[model samples]
Target: MTTAATDLRADAEATLQRLAGSGAQLREDQWRAVEALVAHGRRALVVQRTGWGKSAVYFVATALLRARGKGPTVIVSPLLALMRNQIEAAERAGIRAVTVNSANTDDWQAVYGEVRAGEVDVLLVSPERLNNPEFRDQVLPELSRTAGLLVVDEAHCISDWGHDFRPDYRRLRTLISELPEGVPVLATTATANDRVTTDVADQLGVSGQGDGALVVRGELDRESLHLNVLSLARGADRFAWLAQHLDELPGSGIVYTLTVSAADELAAFLRERGHAVTAYTGKTDPADRERAEDDLLANRVKALVATSALGMGFDKPDLGFVVHLGAPQSPVAYYQQIGRAGRGVERAEVLLLPGPEDKDIWAYFASLAFPGEPQVRVALSVLGDAGRPLSTAALEPRVELSRGRLEMMLKVLDTDGAVKRVKGGWEATGEPWEYDGKRYLGLAKARRAEQQAMLDYITTDGCRMEFLRRQLDDPGAAPCGRCDNCTGKHYDPSVGEDVRVQAQEVLDRPGVPLAPRKQWPSGMDALEVPLKGKIKPEEAAEEGRAIGRLTDVGWGPRLRPLMRSDDLAPDAIVDAAVEVLKGWGWTERPTGIVWLPSRTRPALVESFAQRIAAIGRLPLLGALADDAPPRYSDPEDDSEPEPPNSAQRLAEVYGRLSVPVDLDPSSGPVLLVDDVSDSGWTLTVAAMLLRRAGAPAVLPLTVATTN
Candidate 1:
């Protein structure tokens, strides 16, 4: 099995040259992985640094294997961005690569036909699609049997957090266990500690003992990465710093945020300050995300304000810098993100501006881990009693879990064989499942430890790169002589006084449009709510405004602790609400004011509305009073984000509010006030009641909204 000495070697070399240009050559480790997969048909794991030709190995091996009449290679890629890059590279190598992902749903049939007709050499599929009802029940069985080589990019994801966040990845274990003998399998990752490496290798090995796989690991260090950290006490300060110094850093890059709201907020600030930037977060539309990636790649945008959703999407070796608005929870995760930078450039600046609210964000994500045994039991029982399969949407109301947690649980359960994802949805397998309390405990502990390590990395006086490397358990972890500490060249954290003021002003600028909900929550029939599908256009509230999102940098932090405070909203809060109303730019000024009775924060809502009515000198219409509707309880964990099904919520809110008898609607649009708008259902119901009372229009104004 001397692959390098064989005639097939030329094909592999040519493939590399095609993808990486005429001078491209495979390094010894690349050939070793290629030899294992293509020549000897054995399993292997390659742990190399980013930009170390990991993709090169697989594409070259893919071309070589196809030359010998092997079936198409199926790569289980993790992100849409990663899939796009791989497909582009494969095309350059003349390897017909196609992807099956959520974004390309319309082309799935064509892609499948191509794969079956041997027109495709490489097929990339997202981990989430691994257990898609149709894909899992129909496509996977055949793909599993005929795949020539199996490649798991970002193989580190097979570990704990991956299982929790992307539970469908665990299904690969079953896929690997059932592969026909002698079929080559390769797993690759740039970020994996010893534990992760061993765990992934064990999973990759058919024997399940991990000894059957060849493990190749290289030193994890990037010379082009110049690491530095700047502590910013306030979210506004972070934005101010970026606004002031972003152009001074390097070429085009990314500015990372912990939350979607932060990304949206920061990008708006940067763009207002005359920077070409855009926000890329989990909430961004798939088509828009792709456009943002293209803009960043083309250098049309100076930076992309993004969250972790942009991770692993870059194949660009020339990305100049990466700046974090807040630290990620794990040092390895941080290292992986920063690795996206300095990949192709001689020097790319990597900066971390750790915010005070980082831990809160960390705890929020950590809380989404595997649900408690009781919740799992509820889900299982719901599926068990159902005579037919149930889709995630149909099951969400009964499971009492957020969409994220519910989908995650279903995937984990599917992987465990406790439930099966059939064509329509999931069905209970009647497989007795034991809740692994011990494993969950260990995961929790490991998460805390990793978080501590991340904090240490922030406070460390030692080399930043060395600290990250050591956290990943690299033997060669030592001072890189290039970091801020090692080079004695720290980034100046100072922001110009004027720029700082501008940033604060931007944050303080209130008035976010509260677009009225045109559609009632779907599946309301299950909750016995009369509302279904689209709301009547005439009954809908007119587009309105909120002071700001609760996630806003300036108002959000101030409003967060105030969500529970029933005391009168302070003068400053009242003043901000007035500002949003004053600047609303509405087509028709609200003729009168009406307030919603709050279950919590009654004083705040009334006081804020009273101030607005007094300031505007409008008639003070009475509240849309409620009569003890069943209220949803917050999760004991506090981080399990508010339950998300609007139908169930509508059920609790429907018919609960009544319009004031004395209110006259023919005058004009009336202002409807609330302390906060979350789900927008409460406001929707209120507006409907107001409209029913003959109001020409209802304009909703809230101090804050969760969206």
Candidate 2:
């Protein structure tokens, strides 16, 4: 090697020693990646295994470049948890790292000041922040101008074909295009197939050839990961099995669930079984999430019951086991999640407790995927005609999609250059756009296939590790001598009868309190609805209850198909409803019952309501979804095509429920019932009608609630 090459290697080695230890040595491939970035100023993609020192490459490069007076390294990361870990790790290596994210808004000004003053070596940003108006307009331009190195961590998200779908990642192409020339770029991910790798590299403006990134992909298999799958068809059986076997597992690790409700419910059940555990999901508060992560790292908890929110970039090297309560939809996702375990240990047990509800849960999530052409057209039309930038909430009253879905669609539109996210809100670019129906259809097909692949992982006669490796296009896919399939050492999935009984009780018992809508959705006046601000307490519904959330462990999914049946709710459901009523903390008892009009399954809802009133010996009132003509109507059009937005939907439903005009407030509170609570708007409107018709308090009860 030449003199400068030797010096670069020595500098990188010194940085690695600081990062790892006095004797820490750089791996050959790690050095090559570092050399490409620091010496040649070339783009690099590192696709190493979870513990193969992917992070070391970037940190070492950052140190070497900064020594030569390069600007601070900018890393576009996926999760706040990941950013927190990176910031901590960078500090340990003597790199002054800072983060800008939603959780640290109060610190942003200070952080930006630090960046401007050259006191920071590495800066981590969440992917969504790439287009955040404040960050994108003011802070991001400076980052682009002065960033010495650019890194996209968890780069699989940049691919259209990757297991994870994050639209904000696509904005990296624009960021890359705007970067100053010859700024070395690095992309890293523990999870990515050949397809994803190519897509990400191409998006980074690299073609994987001469003058392109050095794609350094190492072996995908981890010799320390001992894979096993325990198939328990019943939900109760799965939890019982976990309760019985959690202690026998190697060390403190993670027990991943498919839904937030499942994560919370399972964590509680595990605690009841005398295990120290906590639930982690997207719903968890930012500070609490950080605490839970720290607790796990310190071994204060046996395992964190988590959803995919805990999936990417959490650094726990000695995690002994990874247990999945329900299968993830893709084998790639399953492998990357399990990579959290066995990193710094000799052997880490990775177990899959596949439930029958896994497929249904996958289907429910799939329903939230990209919208169809008509909905996309509606949003575009609204934007094109508005002629002004509209914030997401302001646009909601004119669009049919929920807030979450609407935001996701807007991001996708922003990526395609059809719209731009500006300081005020989002502005239409007036770029001609067409929905990629074929592309979306292909994505849908790929999702179904991935779900099948996960199912196949359970029943596959081949090596479990090999099956997962092959799913990611690993050319070195081979039998792992330690897997249950290879060694014939299957786990005993048996649950004690006592454990089963206790778990079944937890499943059978259920009630979820439903909070009433206090404030009206914004931009109602723009939709020509005179309503705005908080609904008067006298005109609002009191807090209510649901038998459970639609994502609950056992009862939630079962209700959907059962709701279509003409027969009344089964005795078990009716019994649960009674329990909910008895447990409800109502200041005054409800004097009567009122059912929401169901556009679908009216007979089922009405029958359920009649049974509840008879059992409670209370009076029954009227139906609500669309039973009464809207209180407000345009004289030119007696009817409006089902109002397309929130304000429109509220206007159409407002004062429409025909409550008895003579009903007396002294008759006491009214029990408002719906078969399902989706968006909770209809329930809000119906409750307002009852309160206006002289009911002192309106309480809403639904069999299940959907997000």
Candidate 3:
């Protein structure tokens, strides 16, 4: 080899050793990726399996390019956990890396200063940061003009066809168009299928151009993983199985759940059974999440019960196992999650405990996709008429979408050029946009197909590894001798009856407190609703109790079906409601009970209230009389009214219920009963009317809450 080429090889080896260990060496394809970027300054896409050392390729390239007097490398990462892990890995190679994300706002100024001063070797940023007002307008332009190398980690998100598409990742196209010529760019992901790979490559300017990106794809196989699937009939059975078999797993690992409520519930149950585990979800506090990650990495805990928030870029090399409590909707997502295990250790167990409710969860998430033309037009019209930028919080009261769905829709609009996110919030751009109904319908169909594929995967009798490889369209798909199906079933499918009984007890336990909404939604006055500011103390309902949340993994299955059907109140639910009442420590005993009028499921609410009244021996007051017409529209109607904010909801229900005009004030507090509490506005307004009728107070009691 030439002197310079030989020297580059030696440097790459030394860097890999620093990153991994003394004996670490790059595979042939990894070296080829590094050479393409550092020597030829060409864009490259590396599609390999997890644990293939994608980060090492970028870190090594960054060092080589910086040594050649190039400017700092900029990486657009997707998650904070990934960024933290990358920064530490970079430091191990003697490369300085800093991150700018929501978790570390105070450090942005200093990080930017370091970048501008040419003292930083690598700068890591979240995809969302690319659209920040100050960062986009001021810092991004300079970074684009001067970056030595650009890296898009978890790059599958750039394509809508990918399993985990993010609109923020789509914003990278703008940044890509601005980069100067001759700057090497690299995109890497382990989860993309053939379609996603091609889409991402074209977006990286790798197709229909001179010297398209060199695509480096290797065999997508992990010899260390022993895959298996166990079908459990119910959620409680899965919990019981985990409690029984978790200790038998090899070492510290992660337990994946499809929903946040499931993660919290499973973690609590595991802890009660004397296991050291913590819940990690989007709802977890930032500091607490970091601590949990650290604990798992250090082997201080048996496992982290987590949702998809723990999916990408978490670096625990020797993690012993990965257990899925429920199946993800797509095989691509499932493969990515299971990839977390057996990265460093051999024979790490990977199991899927499939449940019947998996498809329902998948459908619920699919409903939050990009809004249709009608909804988009409504949002743009609201912004155009306002003639001012509206923050998401302010826009929420004016729109019908939930806060999460609304933010997602706005981001998609912002990317499509129909709206511009400004300093304050968002403004209409007046740009014509077309809602691709065909494309959306196709995407919906694709999602259903994927769900079915996941189901097919569960029932497949062939090699599990080969099944996943074929789903990714990996050309190297072949049977692996490691899977449970390829061999025989290696995992036990049975749990003891005692464990099942214990799990049932935990799931049946009731009482989730319902916190009252204290402050009102913003800008309600413009909507012709008079309510604003903090709720009056006397008008507010006291903190109340519900049998459970509708989303709780324990009670959700039971409560959700009840909400949809007009079935009679289940005896178990009635008993649970009594237990809640017995345990509820009210300062004053309720002298009477009042039932909230239900437009739907009146029988269920009345039956439940009667059961409580008979058990507590309180006088059963008559149901509240509805004087006004039905304020809420039928949920099954396509033209149903948008969900109203607190003010609008209160306005609709105000003066609708009539308490007895001459009800005795000598009666103590009254218990207001409802089938469900969504916004808590009905209870708030109902409490105000009861208090005005001279009752001392009103305490809300419900079968389920939607929060």
Clash count, predicted structure 2? 2
Residue-wise lDDT of candidate 3 within 1-707, one digit each (tens)? 67988889889889888887899999999999998899889999999999999999999999999989999999999999999999999999999999999988999999999999999999999889998989999999999999999999999998878999988887888888899988989999999998899889887775425675788988899999999999888777899999999999999999999888789889999999999999999999989999999999999999999999998999898999999998999999999999999998877999999887777678668867877677678889999998889998778767767677788889888888899889999999999988888978988898888999999999999999999999999999999998899998668778999888989888889998888768766777666666778877876778889998877767988887887766678899989998998899989888998888877788888988898888889888867777888655423222553555454566567646677655543388898899888878788877777777777888899999877
Number of clashes found in candidate 1 = 1
Which residue pairs show collisions in model 3? none
lDDT of 3: 0.87
Off by over 4 Å in 1: 1-11, 162-164, 206-211, 634-644, 660-667
**lDDT score of residue 393 within candidate 1:** 77
Q: Answer with 1 or 3, whichever has the higher TM-score.
A: 3
Across residues 280-314, which tens digit of lDDT does each residue of candidate 1 receive?
A: 99889999999999999999999999989999858
Q: Candidate 1 clashing pairs?
A: 317-344
- Evaluated with lDDT, which candidate comes out highest? 3
How would you order the candidates by lDDT, starting with the best? Answer: 3, 2, 1
Model 3 CA lDDT for position 50: 95
Task: Give each model's clash number.
Answer: 1, 2, 0
**lDDT-best of 1 and 2:** 2
lDDT of 2 by residue, 656-683 (tens): 5555555444378999887777666778
The C-alpha RMSD of each candidate to the native structure, in angstroms, is: 2.7, 3.5, 2.2
